[model samples]
Target: MARVAVVTGASSGIGAATAARLAKDGYHVVLAARRVDRLDALAERIGGRAARVDVTDPSSVREFAQGIESCDVLVNSAGGALGADPVATGEPSDWAAMFSVNVLGTLHVVQSLLPQLAAGGGGTVVNITSTAAFVNYEGGAGYSAAKHAQHALTETLRLELCGKPVRVIEIAPGMVRTDEFSLNRFRGDAERAAAVYADVDRPLSAEDVAECVALAVGLPQHVNVDQLVVRPLAQAAQHKVFRGPLFER
Candidate 1:
């Protein structure tokens, strides 16, 4: 039987791209997301399965896990930023929501599916964190805090699974330009979202991050990539993104 790979947030963005890549790699991918309509379409295209999963809900995650007989890889990519308000001005609700999905949602899925992952004898857990997990900046306090918590969670899992056959990996990307990430963060402000990547050289695409995921997971089971940080050439750092075109086009 082919290896089984579960990708959450598979309705769009990095999760969707990773699902497609893994499917192309010959794994029987399970595309999990709350958006069943999108999931169905992607699943059919990739010859994978579609699963409705709300990572933030423990019961939902539990139900999803129960349907999986075996899992060789689990990618927790069901996370996003809510707003760009300063710490003092950020909405408490936004912070809570971020924490719920990015941290607790991952926790629920991992806890529920860990047994199946371990049973596979060489399972891999890939957590799609962000550079915000390590660095902080103004107007990003809420998202940064949640990602930091997720980073800590991934690290702790690695330590706890020290002797287990499973490998815990963290992939952090900076300045990825996806269709809905920025628009959702700005609450549907198209111009604001567009301005985020205005005139900058090629920002990292969802496929770029998904490629990193496939590479790490494809490595030998004994090889554990503790963390992989990916950023576009135009982005030197979180605060140091080059706005103008970097190459002659």
Candidate 2:
């Protein structure tokens, strides 16, 4: 029997890639996201199950978890950035949306599925965070604040899961080339979305993040990678930039 793995935010980017990757790694991947069509397409390609789940709603998350008999791996990639303006000028509603999905929504999934995990040997959890956790982004206060909460959750969960079979890991990637990211950041401004990746010499792809996740989950059951920070080569540091002559140097 194939071990089951649950992936949130599975409609696009890292979550989508990780779901497919896990399926290739022999786990029956259960993908949950708001975009049912996209999930259905991906699940079809991977021969998995795609279910509509709104993480922001506790009951929705519960129904998704309830359907799972037993789960071995959980990839929490359901977060995204919202609003990129100084807090003084940023939309408070966007900030609230970020928190609702990134922090509270994560807790909803964790709480609903934890008992299943505990009963099934305490499965591993990989929460997708951001490099923004350790640094600040101007006009990105809301996204950062929500991710900070996730960072805390990762660390706290790790400690709490100690000695148990479960492991909680965090993958903080910088500048991943996922349209879902830029679209969310710019609130569906496609022009702004295109500009974000255009300036960079190279940006991390969704598959790159998924590769790291696959590697982490591939490890021996006794081994645990607490946190993995991945960034594009051009992104030396949070605010630091390396120049390339071809594009917008």
Candidate 3:
């Protein structure tokens, strides 16, 4: 039987890309997300299954878990940034929303699927974090804090799962240019979202980050990658980015 890999946030962006890549790698992928239409489309293309799951809601996660008979790999990718306002002026709602999805959402899914992950005797948990998880930057306090919490969660899970049949991996990417990430962060402001990647020479794409997930999961079960931080060459750090053409167009 093929290994079953469950990818949350599989409706679009990194999640969607990872699902497709994992399918190509011969895993029976389960595409989970709140967007049923998008999930269905991707699921059909990849010959996988589509599941409606709101990772932010514990009840939804529990319900989703009930349907899966076995899960060899679980990719917690159902997360995003809401806004980029400064801390002092940032809306509390936005902060709460970020935490709910980035931190708690991951927690809910992991907790619910842990049994199935461990049952297979060689399971893997891949958390899709971001550079914001490790560093602080202006206009990114809320998202950063949430990611930091998630990073901590992934670390602790690795420790707690020691000797268990599961491997916890963290794949953090920087400057990934995804379709809805920036646009959602700016609340549908297309101009602001487009400007985020303007002039940057090939910011990381969804497939770039997805490849990281596939790599970590494809490794030997006994070999665990504690954390993998990926960033485009143009972005040296959270606050440093080269906004010029560095490659041939």
Cα lDDT of model 1 overall? 0.97
User: Candidate 1's residue-wise lDDT over 1-249, tens digit each?
Assistant: 999999999999999999999999999999999999999999999999999999999999999999999999999999999999998789999999999999999999999999999997789999999999999999999999999999999999999999999999999999999999999999999999999999889999999999999999999999999999999999999899988878887
Model 2: lDDT equals 0.89
| Model 3 misplaced stretches (Cα beyond 4 Å) | none
Say which prediction, candidate 1 or candidate 2, comes out ahead on lDDT. Answer: 1
| Model 2 stretches astray by more than 4 angstroms | 245-249
lDDT of 2 by residue, 1-249 (tens): 889899999999999999999999999999999999999999999989999999999999998888988989988999888768998898888988999999888899989988777777558888999998878878778888899999998899889878788888899998888867889788789998887777678788999999999999889877899899999888888787665643553
Superposition error at 11 for model 1 (Å): 0.2
TM-score of each: 0.99, 0.95, 0.98
Predictions in order: lDDT: 0.97, 0.89, 0.95
TM-score winner, 1 or 2: 1
Q: Which 10-residue window in model 2 sums to the lowest lDDT?
A: 240-249
